[model samples]
Target: MDKKITNYIIYAVFIVLLFLSTLFKSFSTDVLWPKDQNAKGSFDGIIFSDPQDISGLNVTRTIFKENNKNLVKYDVSFLYEGDFGNLRILGNPVSQIFLPNKMNPVFSDVTLKGEYNKINNALFQENLKLKDLYKKVPDHEFSTTSKIRVPLDKEVPEVKFSMLYEPRQITHGLKGNIAQNAVFVTNARVESFRDTTKQEKGIKNESKNFQESGYYVNSIEVINEKQIKSISFESTLNSIVFIISLATAILLIWLDKNKSQVPLLISMMLSIMTVSRFLDKGATTFGILFIWTITGYLASLLSYAITSEENKIKTRDFKRSIAWTLIFLLVNIIVFIIPRTF
Candidate 1:
């Protein structure tokens, strides 16, 4: 094959792989919101459930405090069946009963059995900063975790809890569920409310959608009041980062083809991928590049031993070059594990 053609093919392959992986991992590609639909609608709150338990709306239930402008509660119970007995759920701070006056939503109480435990507002705020549970929020408090641990030692792992929140928007009715990580809830009960609520409190059933009762929640809504006129700050920043990453990728590919700086190009591309992952999704731009530059350079020295040209640019070992490049590319693909395979 023509040398130029070979380079272009390699460039195209790398570009496609990186592009798809980034898009798959980046939620910021769309409007900067938690949920998919963007309109003025009251949010019924979102919960990030541990994927191990395979919890969904079918196994979950929700109920709201009967009072308005007070507290909104999520009554949830999970049937644990996974290795990680410690169930972890994080609430997206942007999507719930925030204080009527402030943009903050603080968890007032977390109940496991019947007893409610008080969590410090500051500690919860601090937890959001650490990515141990999830990503770091940019401007202010992003997400909060109100964990209710259901120990495996218990005879029956059927755990129940009521989480109270200040009413920002009234979310009632188990309108629907969103993936294994998130489930939305409303304030009112559904047709199966009686049997479901029998496990907890007595509630009336108004909806017609009936299922064999066992924790069926009612009422979840989306109010189309909060709408964005222009691109948000974070969204704008993400866009910029994306543009930079793409441009840098192109530049690195071009340089690699002409100058044959294989290790340098691979390292930089790896770095851009990490930085583009703003939420620390996997890693960062500089951090990833640094590791790649250091490690790939040191490892790729074998290429020199395979080449006889001492004049640097006099002769090209296209076959050896392709092998080393493919090796690095394959390593990255496997390491990052796309959809996050950047």
Candidate 2:
């Protein structure tokens, strides 16, 4: 076999192996970025609740990939006519996806699904007043409904709140999302607006809740940098590059009669890119970095050098590649460490 053709075949074979390994890593269930199929084994961020919230409290966030971006659809839940009514999602609203406005967020994705307990608007000839609405509806802890602000003369039926004394399993389907580094915050109070003593309770309670001990806020992380990167450049991008290079190498071996350096150059470039991506993430000790740098540089050089054009080694090129590899590896290590120090 001609040495040039053998080199192309061997390089194609190496890329084929890389493609196979990456295919496994990207598609395996245990690997990262599951539902985001377009970018499997990539950095698709995480959707999680705040650490302080016991059992994630009322926030239920599910992280999935959609349209090549990490989409988080979460149900921000609280008691009926309760905290979530005054909810405010405050943080870095950097995401270009579904984010709720700061004030009047309930209107963003409202789903009114509960009734007022012990209140009958049908019995009254005139529309129920706010006082009647408040006094007639008994307190029940389990009813879940979207908050609706009606005029003082509006009927309880107009509110369409499904309130009851009986316990019902809540399907907190009120969905909301925030971009990376943002939070879902709510100025929810522990008290209900069952106070019928003042007709102004509806207006006053919110202000009171905002000012007093009843003022409480809970935060749920919408998405953050700390999330497990499901699809990363190392895993998915390299896999793609490997596929493209493998195809090119096959074409060169079968069709291109001329001896070309493109195949070997691709192999070397890919090795450097793969090593760079690896060093971009994960904690790497000096030992790991040393082995990785040496392996990456030597493997690429040897892939071409062993089947040299004249069957001789390029010692200067090998040394230069080693020096450049070490420099880049050290630079990556520094870049990785500098951010964590702060």
Candidate 3:
């Protein structure tokens, strides 16, 4: 094959790979907030469950703002099939419930329903009118916990459980600063458990004693009209930065196709990506994209340095660079994207 033809082929492959990386990253669900003006917040979490005992699980979260306060509603549903004697479920601490400063819980309610012996039954239900449960913790922050119990029979082979709750949290100004319209962020930890106590039908036994558990987080966001507008504006600025940086990197490579220039181009790209992290707060997508870009650039630079001349780049150097770049890209996709995507 002609050396020039091989070099062109390598460039074409590089462009395709770059395009695919950008497209995939842009569509990643890791970006919690959408560019849409109506998007108020995002929810994402992993549910760890015993494959042998639990068959399926589903979780949903909803957020609402009323009376100048932000309220979060959570719905957790799951299916289990196993001997009741072997079943165990545990819950994590509900510390994330207190957010946007200390919040006096307007109300904390829990309702649990399940099926036993092929018959629909209300296993456990409770509505705690928690005026006294709400107490100030350290730092003068108010916190509360809701407890519910579901009585189960050991002979039952299959059970489906569903729980729902809504807790109203006060929306204070951003962390330390007080603003008229500030974005409120919080998360909920919902856990599934089985009754392990020898006793039957008690709130303390239901809430306090359990083992072998699975949990998930429901991230809540409450933003007013003005805060939503600010998010939209920031997103626009991020888009502009992304475009300019990408264009500049490509232009530099096209104008000066020398191995010596690769390092400078890579530095410029990294700087732009780092700046992107500040433009959008708490965004992991930018970090992931930056890592991917850096890996590719470093791999190409290494390959070029090993194969190229001091004064000029050759076709073989380009081909070798593409080979190493592809290897690095594969490693990145395996290490980062695979687990997140799956």
Winner by TM-score: 2
Q: Give the poorly placed runs of model 2, Cα more than 4 Å off.
A: 12-238, 245-263, 271-288, 327-331, 334-342
By the TM-score metric, which is better: model 1 or model 3? 3
All candidates in order of TM-score, best leading: 2, 3, 1
lDDT of 3 by residue, 188-241 (tens): 233442222222222111122111122222222122334434544655676776
Better of 1 and 2 by lDDT: 1
TM-score of each: 0.26, 0.31, 0.29
**Cα lDDT tens digits for candidate 2, 1-342:** 876666665665554544333332222322211122211111111111222221222434343445565443434433222222222232222232232223222223233231221122221222212222122122311122323221211111111111111111111111111112111223333222221112121121111112212223221222212121333333577566645654665555455443444454454545434532332222234423554455556545655453455534476767766665666576657754354445
> In every candidate, how many clashes are there?
28, 13, 2
lDDT of each: 0.34, 0.33, 0.34
Q: Model 3 segments beyond 4 Å from truth?
A: 1-12, 19-27, 33-222, 225-230, 257-264, 267-294, 297-342
In model 2, where is the ten-residue run with the lowest total lDDT? 166-175
| Model 1: per-residue Cα lDDT over 1-342, one tens digit each | 544344445545544544444443332322222333322222233232343443432333333335332234455444445554333233433233312221123343352221011122222233212212112222222223343232332244444444454433222111111101112332213222221322212222222221112222233222222221121343456556656655665554455433445543554354344443453243333334344333334334422321212313222444555466566655665654342332
- Looking at model 1, residue 8 earns an lDDT score of 49
Q: Tell me the lDDT of candidate 1.
A: 0.34
Model 1 lDDT, residue 282, Cα: 38
Report the error of model 2 at residue 12, Å: 5.4
